[model samples]
Target: MPNLSTTYLGVPLKSPLVVAASSISSHVDRVQMAESAGAGALVIRSLFEEQIQLDSMQLDEFLAAGSDSFSEATSFFPKIEHGGSKEHLMWVEKTRKAVSMPIFASLNAVSPGAWVTYAKQLARTGVNGLEVNLYSVPTDMGKSGSDIEKALYEVIESIKAEVALPVAVKLSPYYTSPANVIKQLEQHGAGAVVLFNRFLQPDIDPDTETLVNEMVLSNPAELRVPLRWAALLYGRTRLDLAVNTGVHTGRDAIKALLAGATVVQVASTLLQNGIPYLSTMLLDIQNWMDERGYKSLDDFRGKVSQKHCDDPFAFERAQYVKLLSSIH
Candidate 1:
């Protein structure tokens, strides 16, 4: 059997397959199952800024609802706050204690202060690292690309200053200069950059005239986008690059490694196929390595990247023209 060990964000992973942040940590039993199933590590479901804000507003509404009708009615109910980030922090702490494998806490905060505060608090949970989910919908037309990027830089800077844990920024693929954005993050002490976050799109119901938001699992076809970027940016940056989205099987994990990813983060597959399926993917990679006479992951990692591949243009617009002409 080939050695499957790989280092991600300065942390040594027994394997290169990590469970991406999702509802997987909602149950401690599921997390333990993933560890047993051969997951390199698991990121706890993100503590979102919007969710914290919504919770605060709801608490205010509940506290003020019956204050006018009957002052005593408000007193009868405890002034305790519920649905806040306190539960999330406590849950992360609990999850950290439950699993012996490396566990990273995911955080998504809106304000700079909140980013620093929450990141610091999450670090205190005794987790291995932090995945700063810079997940947001940039709808402001007035905001220039530079302005938006500056805000992201500030968030990274703030978190780095307050948190001692290894920080990996989970970036949105919407940036005009994704490479430049990553360069700044690297300069700001980012341990790793998860290639691209899969931001959910809201769809409108034609008849009902309302937005319907739902969970949609990624398919193998979606791997191309991150694969190209990972290949293109390979050898160009020092920061560890993690591939996320579209990693459904062992072959899919191989594709990411070939494209120069330090590791691959998978979520949808485990959701659709169960956590134990991770062992199947790892087996596939190992079998393929053995067949090829490769001793370890590094033997063929980035073997097909732009820096090492014969046809570098295959990852860029040059291939688009070639592909179009060949189709007809």
Candidate 2:
């Protein structure tokens, strides 16, 4: 059997396939199942401060809307149980006790003080590491791109100051220059960088004249974006790069490693398929390695990356233009 062992953020993993933060971590049994099914690590569902605040705001709006139209509406709703960071901290601790694999707690979109406070509390849970989901949406017209990047740096620095756990920042791909962001994060002591965070885009319902706000699982084609960037960034920085946002198969995972990704994170794929399916993906990757006579993941990890590939320009826009022109 080929050696699938690899390390991310200085933490050793059995394979490069990591279970991304999602509802799969909600149950202790499920997390254990993932580990048994061959996951490298598990990132618990995020403690999303912004998501909690959004829920609160919507609740207030609901009460206000009903206060005037229906007097009984105010009394009908149940008390909001946002579960706050305290509840999340307890749950993460429980999960940590249940599993032997490296457990990472996610803290997303937190306030200034909450970043330090929650980060400290989470680190106390005995998790192996932390994943900071830097969910930045550039909606504010006044906030320049530089302002957003600076805020991200401060967030990481605050968390680092509060905790000793290895931390990885999950970033959005919309940044003006993602490589620069990674360089800054490396300087700020980030152990790893999860390539891209997927944003929930709101759709419109023309018939109802309302919005369509729901989560959509990613498809395999979405892997291209991170694949390109990962290959381009392979030898450019010292930061560990984690490819996410469209990896769904064993072949997909292999592609990421070939492009120099330290690891590949999956959430939607597990959700769409069964959790046991993880073992299948791992088996497929193992078969590929055996056929290629690759003894370890590092044997050909970056073989196809820009640094080692025959054509470095294959990852750039110049190649993209040439391919299109050649087609006609």
Candidate 3:
């Protein structure tokens, strides 16, 4: 069997297939199943700052609603303390204890202070690492791309200063210059970078004139974006690259590795198929490697990247032009 072992953010993984942060990690049994199914590591569902804030607000409202009803009822609440992120912290720690594989906690926050505070708390959850989700849709017209990048750097710097765990930044693909932003992240102490963060876009019900929000899982076709970026960034930086979104099978994972990704994080495929499907993907990779006579991932990893590929512009616009010309 070909050696599938690889490392990410300095943490060794038996395989390169990582479970991306999603609802899949909500169940402890599923997490253990992922480990059994051959996942290298798992990133727990993110602890959103907005969710914590909303919970705190709801609790405050409930506590104050009946406080003014009567003097005796003022203490009726029993001085209960708001859980805040206590439940999420406990969940992360519980999941960590349930499996022997590396468990990485994810955090999504809006402010620098919140990022640092939550990162510190998550670092105490016995997780092997942290994945910071920089997910946001910029609606403010006044904010320039540089401003957004600056805020990201500040948050990264703050979290790195406050926490001891390795940090992986899950970046938004909409950046003006993703490579430049990635370089900045490296300078600010990010150990790794997830190629792209999938954003959920709301749809409109034209007949009812209402907004509809639904979860749409990724498909294999979505792999191209990260694939190109991974190939482009292979030899450009020292940061580990994790290709996420659109990886559905063993060949997809191999494609990522060939493009120089340190590992491939999958969630949609597992959710759409089944947890056991992870082992199938790994088996597919192993079979393909054996057939190709590749003993280890490094044997051909980055072999097709822009830095090493025969066609240096394969991931560039020249290829795009060639494809269009060929279409005619």
Ranking by TM-score: 3, 1, 2
**Least lDDT summed over 10 consecutive residues: which range in candidate 2?**
77-86
lDDT of 2 by residue, 1-328 (tens): 9998888888889988899999999999999999999999999999888766777788678778877787786677676554556778899999999988889999876467878777888999999999998875678999899988898899899889879999999989888788899999999989999988888899999999999999999999999999988998998888888999899999999999999999999999999898999999999999999999999998988888899999988887738776788985
Model 3 agreement with the true structure over 185-218: per-residue lDDT tens digits:
9999999999889989999999999999999999
| Among all candidates shown, the one with the greatest TM-score | 3
Better of 2 and 3 by TM-score: 3
**Ranked candidates, highest lDDT first:** 3, 1, 2
Question: Between candidates 2 and 3, which one is better according to lDDT?
Answer: 3
Error of 2 at 81 (Å): 11
- Local accuracy by lDDT, each model: 0.90, 0.89, 0.94
Best by lDDT: 3
Worst 10 residues of 1 by lDDT: 75-84
Which sections of candidate 3 miss by over 4 Å? 68-71
Q: Candidate 1 residues 133-214, lDDT tens each?
A: 9888888999889998888888887788877889999988888889899899999889899978998889999999999999
Better of 1 and 3 by lDDT: 3
Query: Clashing residue pairs in candidate 3, if any?
Result: none
Where is the poorest 10-residue window by lDDT in model 3?
A: 68-77
Candidate 1, position 88, lDDT: 93
List runs of model 2 lying over 4 Å from the truth: 51-83
